[model samples]
Target: MITLTDVHKAFGAKHVLQGVDLTIDKGTSMVIIGGSGTGKSVMLKSVLGLVTPDSGTITVDGNDVQRGDRDAFLARFGMLFQGGALFDSLPVWQNVSFRLLRGALKRPKEEAREIAIEKLRRVGLKPETADLFPSELSGGMQKRVGLARAIAAEPEIIFFDEPTTGLDPIMAGVINELIREIVTEMGATAMTITHDMSSVRAIADNIAMLHDGVIKWTGPVSKLDNSGDPYLDQFIHGRAEGPIEAVR
Candidate 1:
């Protein structure tokens, strides 16, 4: 459903996304794995049109990302940010329905609240949690809220940025399962960028390893262990010595 061909992006002296080429099939979950500063985020942002590539092209369902109505294009996507990113001032319901309460997807306040409650329930949050503030929730609950917000609009595409960050292992597992189930149920195309191997195994139908601003390997998850690509092997095994240099 999404495709990037020979994509390249650079910021001043920093050459990020030197030539990223990837394709995400419809209704499939794709996980991008890479170490810090390898431009995974840059590749994702290029697809989202948040970061323009210096060369090549990005298309979603055959339409060029750079030539669309920004709002309309963006409305088709949902994002679960790494930090949860909930507005501290808004109540839980408000935060979940923030998209529905304004702009292209606007709905009646009551209707939006109802939808928010349903989405919250899907993410394992109770309706009673709706009125509480972000500050009042535990870390796991806050993450659930973020997931609820991401699905509230029923977006065709979902992006997860380090979804398991800051959570305990158990909670991270829960989040991974929820993400997998929700994406499958909604039949949404998912693109997740995370270093967590557990999350990759739980959430990905396919995997892509990005390094040095390029896709070093891309294939089905079943073949991950045997890809024979040194870069991917180093990443998946967390090896200290390999083609990848571990900074001391």
Candidate 2:
């Protein structure tokens, strides 16, 4: 559903993506894993056309990402940000239905609220929680809210950025399971950027390791352990000594 070929991006003296090539099949989950500052986020932003690349191309369903009606193009995607970026001012329902309440996807306020509630339920949140603010929720609840917002638009593509950050192990596991289930049930193409190996194991159908601004390895998740790539092995095993330096 998505493809990147010979993609490269640089900011002044800092060269980020040198030649990132990746493909995400329709209705499948693809996770990009790498250490901090390895350009994982930059790759995603390039695909989204938020950060224009210096060279190469990104296409969704064979259409060039950089050329399109901006609003129409972006409307097809939903994003769960790394920081659970909910508005402190808006109520839970408003936050979840932000897109639906305005722009081309707008719905009646009452209808939007109902859809928000349903999405919230899908993420294991309750109706009562809709009226609550982000501050009133726990970290796990906030993450669930973020997930709720991501799927509320019924987007064809979903992007998850560090889905399990800041949660306890148990909550992280819950979030991972929820993400896997939601993506499967919705039949949405998913691209997630996270270094969490546990999240990778639970949510990925295919895995790609990004290092030094390019994809070092890409394959089915089942073959990850036996891939025999030093960079990949060092990353997945969290080894202190390997091809990848501990200090970035």
Candidate 3:
């Protein structure tokens, strides 16, 4: 399991996370939901070590994240950035297997290319598209490529940042289902940050609500609609007249 105990973080005078205690069971999908500036992304970043916490203990499978080999620890996880952060100069296959081509997970060039193509196919992309550049694919296709890359290494954990941010509703739904399928098939621990309720419903096994520098509520996805927390109700329902400030 991935556990965060008493996690806290601040930037100058602005405090973000405050004593966040979250537990993500192994092989389950946990989606963090919150309004803007509620520290959702910050919390995710802290777990990834992109942003260090002021005080806390973050552990994966009982291994302390901060006290491990950075590269080896990271090798066990994969991240899908919000905007499909693909390199324009590399072909789709190269982008997918970028990690496999070098570093700790390095493989022969031909083997890496093969794995990339296989992963692309897993994400519903054609083999021929492997030779194309990111600029040539549509927004949805780009997201698929991003996902293929995320799963290319078959990491034990995957972090998704705004999985469906720019796609149309149908495409978004497709991505959500694809994510669910991939996670379920691989039994990978997933932590996703999204404001998309449709995505939360389709992808999460458990949901946690982050608000006002703390987690207001955390429970199974089935409990979301009836959680009885005004903050959660307001945010999920997209209501302007509730506990949450309308302008925040």
Off by over 4 Å in 1: none
Error of 1 at 114 (Å): 0.8
lDDT per residue for candidate 2 within 97-213, as digits (tens), equals 999999999999999999999999999998999999999999999999999999999999999999999999999999999999989998999999998899999999999999999
The worst-scoring run of ten residues by lDDT in candidate 1 lies at: 41-50
Span of ten consecutive residues with least summed lDDT in model 2 = 239-248
For model 3, how does the per-residue alpha-carbon lDDT over 128-178 read when each residue is reduced to its tens digit? 999999999999999999999999999999999999999999999999999
Put down candidate 1 lDDT per residue, 110-168, tens digits, no spaces. 99999999999999888999999999999889989999999999999999999998899
User: Candidate 1 clashing pairs?
Assistant: none
Better of 1 and 2 by TM-score: 2
- Evaluate all candidate structures by whole-model CA lDDT and list the values in order: 0.94, 0.94, 0.94
lDDT of 1: 0.94
> What is the model-wide C-alpha lDDT for candidate 2?
0.94
TM-score of each: 0.97, 0.98, 0.98
